[model samples]
Target: MSLTSVFNIAGTGMSAQSTRLNTISSNIANAETVSSSIDQTYRARHPVFATVFQNAQGGNNGSLFADKDQSGAGVQVMGIVEDQSSLMARYEPNHPAANEAGYVYYPNVNVVEEMADMISASRAFQTNVEMMNTAKQMMQRVLTLGQ
Candidate 1:
């Protein structure tokens, strides 16, 4: 792996963590939201990620002997998926959003879980930033070696 590729790998990690943080924020924001129907209730969203492999030949050059042992290039966001867990149903007869049966459907989002996820994503983002900074420092040191 080249020194420059470190930046790409860390950049992708930061991007993925950003997406994760966004989803956690959304989940936390809707944790207490109540809906009149199950269909309208908010479902906790999570972002899926996948490893992006670098082209063995590099830069699209069709080399006869491509390096097959090359490691991962970066990470990519697959998609955001909604949780399939059941929504919370509460008996609030006087609530305006309650259904005919006096039941109000709450979002499936769990505040505690969302908060934990937020913390984890934030830590991951910080780690990626640190990795990028370290790579930059290493490159700078390399440049000074010949001086």
Candidate 2:
């Protein structure tokens, strides 16, 4: 793969990680949100990502794996999916959002898990930035070869 491709791949990675971080932040922010009903409760959201690959002819074949004739393009955000797990129900009858059954529904978001995911996404973004910088440095060094 060419050094220029590295920049594109890393850029895509950074974008994907940014989306992930956004979802993580949203989950954390809504972790304490209360609702009178389960249907109105905020569910934890997570981003789904997929790898992009290009064939030898530079066309995407939608293949999951890159063979000898294929190269990895980068990561793509598939979509944001809500956690299917059960939401938290508390017996807070005095709460403003309490249901008729004296139970308040909270988001399924786990603050600790969200924090860990945030850190991981941040690291991934930083790694992508470092990769782009390294690619730039390599290109700069190649230019100095003729000096």
Candidate 3:
């Protein structure tokens, strides 16, 4: 609820978005990777996030008695999870990675989807930066008011 808290919240958002971008990059990088077997195929990874809430006592809202004024403090990265969808299996008999049955397994990552996610994550990170800058400017103006 304070100007200082804005910086913390925005910082956390930027961090989360950065993690998202990293996963998008990884997925895109492995999009064309082919494996000899399904078990060896790369799976698309995504970052999971959770919001951190602030309680009325200015601490984390982790207690049952916490007041209703539980505002979002920031974001946290829960974990990165691999997509459980089926891998792409293609019949590339001549390919080096082809299996004995003439099938090659490719990653489930979709380049277009990964690109879209990259753009979204980049925009979210930019937004967080702008928020932090706005909070900084506001704090500066408040300091100038006293002078």
TM-scores, each model vs. reference: 0.91, 0.91, 0.92
Ranking by lDDT: 3, 2, 1
Q: Cα lDDT of all candidates, in order?
A: 0.88, 0.89, 0.90
lDDT of 3 by residue, 18-57 (tens): 9999999989988999999888899999999998888533
TM-score leaderboard ranking: 3, 2, 1
Candidate 1, residues 1-147: lDDT per residue as tens digits?
A: 688989999999999999999889888888889998999889999999998876732552343444654477899999999999998999999999999999999988878878888889999999999999999999999999999
Regions of candidate 1 where Cα sits further than 4 Å from its true position: 56-70
Candidate 2 scores a C-alpha RMSD against the true structure in Å of 3.4
Clashing pairs in 2: none
Where does the lowest 10-residue lDDT sum fall in candidate 2? 60-69
Against the correct fold, how does model 1 do in TM-score?
Answer: 0.91
Give the winner by TM-score.
Answer: 3
What is the TM-score of candidate 3?
0.92
Lowest lDDT sum, 10 consecutive residues, model 1, at 56-65
Return the number of clashes found in candidate 1. 0
- Candidate 2 segments whose C-alpha is farther than 4 A from its true place: 60-69
**Count of clashing residue pairs in every prediction:** 0, 0, 0
